[model samples]
Target: MKKQLLLLVLLFLGSIALLQSQVTGTVTDEDGTPLPGASVVKKGTRVGTTTDFDGKFSIDAIIGDRLTISYIGYQPKEVLINSTIMSITLVSGVQLAEVVITGSRNPNRTATESTVPIDVIDVKQLANAAPQVNLNQILNYVAPSFTSNTQTISDGTDHIDPASLRGLGPDQVLVLINGKRRHTSSLINVNGTFGRGSVGTDLNAIPTAAIQRIEVLRDGAAAQYGSDAIAGVINIILNKNVDELLINVT
Candidate 1:
């Protein structure tokens, strides 16, 4: 009797595993053109895949699986799959509005509600502009008050000075990557004659292709981001949806 019971349990488990299915399909834009290198993720989970050159993709998931489809310059689409061979159509890209977070720690709050002034750069704008190499080239000249100085250094380290937010030193200005604080460069000094110094972000650490948007707050935010907030804050938001095997055709 014990041996028979064990066999029944094993068989039940095996059957359940087989019930889970795999889903696959090609992704395309509304114009019926193939969208290669598009991101296809299982909604809520990190499991995902990118479309190949032919805009073809395959992924493993069970029935009633929720999948998210996203591509740069295109609107994201989510679908619930109950069968095999699901073709997804993504819409034309929409221009996203500028979103800023100022007062308090709440992300839902906008710049209007806060005491500080936050500058928002939409991702669509950056993609359309097609910046080359470092993001510093663009961020420095684009914003009103911010200034970037590129100093050529020969000390074996890649030398690109940090950006100055309203002439404040680099150390005084806090830099956040993907909304998380990153370590400042230990090599250079951002402080100048002014109580604030000449510090800038090493844009090389971040790739323009991966950037989603950049937010610059032009007021004092010591209370929100802590001590480094003395000068101001620059937040670099990275895209979480891209899945391209980038091949730079030089």
Candidate 2:
């Protein structure tokens, strides 16, 4: 009878211990404000949860469970949970140096060929750059060599700034989006139908949000991108693996 009573006592203690093993913590930004909807995930695993409105979250785990916290516009953080902490702070994200596309026509060109002088901009930079509705706004401060000249015609319609590729005229340069040719908007307003309003990728139509990176030859390129590539070549790479939900409004 004593043995039976001892066994029951042990089983009850085991149940209580199991219930106490869950891990929990609160997540906040650098400013100490609660970050609702921030994702907390296990390192290298799909198991994860989002913080509640109160910035609180809980998950079942054992000792040494690695956790990763991530949110938009913030640097992702990782923590190893050996003990319980009431709150975790996440830092703001900064742009790290990235491999920019360069010198494709001559595959032999070394990585340091900034001599060609291409201005490559990433989509994420657009948020901080705060560009206007048209591509002209984004390019205005990008390159000193290129100038954007917009003039209003007799009608209320505003004229687009001609993309001057080293003053070589728009027809000489080739504009490609993801290697595909985009139709010209109207005639190259500068050169007439033959040149057609400097027809190239309507940088506006491609949506800067969808761009991953841009590669500009900055030098003459007739062999690789083809005949129209006299002035220079501007190639826009689209983001294939990006989530559609990452849209931002200026």
Candidate 3:
């Protein structure tokens, strides 16, 4: 009787092991594109796995278990494990505002640490916000203090638009590329504009693709960089980490 009772207990334990199931799924975007690097985790548990290159994933779970899926730039999802296979779809999330860098010759300073108000725009954010290929137009919309308008028929000035900061002349706003002084445009704005006699830098001369990020110092820096930076200063940092070729048709 003792041996028979021990055998019954072993069988019950074996049945519990067989009841546990393996769950498999594929994570995709709303458009059905496979989203690699998406995370899958068991709800209220530490067990998790990231989707493979093909957006496929597998995890050990049982029936009635809840799985949570998430990815960057996409909405998270939760589903009950009713079936062994699941096809999870995630929607795109709203784009967050880019953070700005402030108050330091060193580019590594955070926004909280600096006392001066500064605006920083990354290349990705600029490309998305820019309506046209012109760099001046991008800054006009992104920077609150900067302003520019496309000229219709003003000879050579029409090609190069004048830009100003804090309602001041464009020349008063110093331009810097990679922390160095950028040359001013030869075409001075002799027309009736905010920057009438000032020869400002041709902001559109530099392609948006080549830039890594732009830091605009909203405060006056005459004591730091001389009279040219009376209104403010703009520092355009070039892209140094180029790993892949980017082709822009428009």
Ranking by TM-score: 3, 1, 2
The whole-model lDDT of each prediction reads 0.73, 0.68, 0.84
Candidate 2: the clashing residue pairs are: 187-196, 187-197, 188-196, 188-197, 188-198, 189-197
Residue ranges of candidate 3 with Cα displaced over 4 Å: 1-110, 242-244
Candidate 2 segments exceeding 4 Å error: 1-118, 130-133, 154-160, 190-201
Q: How do the residues 68-118 of candidate 1 rate in per-residue lDDT, one tens digit apiece?
A: 999999988999987878889999967879868754333432355556667
| Tens-digit lDDT track of model 3 for 30-103 | 89999999999999999999999999999998878999999998978899988889999999975668867763
Sort all candidates by lDDT, best to worst: 3, 1, 2
What shift in Å separates residue 205 of candidate 2 from its native position after superposition? Answer: 2.3
TM-score of each: 0.47, 0.46, 0.53
Output the worst ten-in-a-row residue range by lDDT, candidate 3. Answer: 103-112
Please give the lDDT score for candidate 3: 0.84
Task: Identify the candidate with maximal lDDT.
Answer: 3
Output the better candidate (2/3) by lDDT: 3
